[model samples]
Target: MIADIDGNASVSNATGKPLTKRGEATRTRLLEAAEVVFAEQGYHEASIVKITERAGIGLGTFYLYFDSKQSIFEALVIDLNRRVRHSMAEAMAGTSDRIAAERAGFAGFFRFTAQHPALYRVVREAEFVSPEVLKLHYTRIVEGYEAGLARAKESGDIDRRLDPEVTAWALMGMGELIGMRFLLWERDENGLPPAQLDERVFTAMTQMIDNALAPRREGNHDD
Candidate 1:
């Protein structure tokens, strides 16, 4: 990772010049290092020095691209979100079926989280502590789900009787909570083998969605 000599919040190069190929490479290194640092150590605990060291850059160089460790962490989060949004867009664009889109999108998310468990932990944990980040992340995801739910309802895949916004929120919350429970919260005893996380999460999520979408009993007020 090439460290920018100038302390600026832009992802520029070491010379404090425009972002060339080398500059972009340096920026990528910084973001990648930030991801690892934030994942291994919580945001508050991570240091700019550590991040720079991880990126193989000097502390001054670190400052050139990011004002502080917080900025770098935010950049990492933004990058992750961008990747997720891109993946979802690709899945949706490729398919006309809502169910297929949801399944593919969720599977992509699951795979991404599985591969970057540490980074996911950093972002997930940061949400409550960082309202700005939370809002940004939630808005992107919620909008996507709402749009998806609308499509599903139109296609007769989802129950049009239900409020699409509310239903989408419920489904999103379920998937997130379940992912956290099975992926983030797993200790030694609770941890499934790495290979099983995807299948287990998918099965659990599918079952939960199925149960929620099933017709309620006459006396049941439960969702």
Candidate 2:
């Protein structure tokens, strides 16, 4: 399990308190250091020595907290996923409609990517290149999305013929595709004001999501 406040072993086999202040501090430092290192250099290129140096800790100290650089990377991904889920939960708590919920959810996601560009890059890379990491990061969110689809079906909000699981995954894919385009700067652009660029991107995303979920008109329900 996890450790106590003084940075000592709090658990003797099983029973113990949370991490000590020093333990927690060390943990935070490692995570911060890993985040920067992983962001600066892709996961394959990042080294334990670099991360420890950034954390200002010894190599043995790194092992005391984590097994390997891969473990730390997994921890970082899990941490980011938790933060994203928390943000989505907060946004969803106030909205009932699916479209409204998606809008708020995507807005929160957009803000997160805007704020944590490096982390976003890491997540995007993992999606295409690391199946294990992708599943680890996405399983919970996919479960929740499936639940929403079930609700939509029950309410006659979605076509009863559509598989909820497939629909949920498709929705997730759509969001990720849009996010990659917006945040990755995949297109070539020179110097521009950051604020204007952010605003333009945010507005474009809001419109994209709106159009994506717009209600089908009577005659146009040809699907």
Q: Per-residue lDDT tens digits of candidate 1, residues 17-64? A: 667677678888988888888877888788988888998988877766
Off by over 4 Å in 1: 1-18, 90-93, 186-201, 210-223
What TM-score, to 2 decimals, does candidate 2 have?
0.74
- Backbone clash pairs in model 2 (N, Cα, C under 3 Å; residues 3+ apart or in different chains), count: 6
Q: Assess candidate 1 and give its lDDT.
A: 0.67
How many pairs in model 1 have backbone atoms within 3 A of each other, for residues 3 or more apart or on separate chains, i.e. clashes? 1
Off by more than 4 A, model 2 = 1-18, 124-130, 157-161, 186-220
Global lDDT of each model?
0.67, 0.66
Model 2 C-alpha lDDT per residue in residues 105-213, reported as the tens digit of each score: 7667656655566657677667654557757667767887889767866675655565778867877777676666665554346421122125666577667655555
Worst 10 residues of 1 by lDDT: 1-10
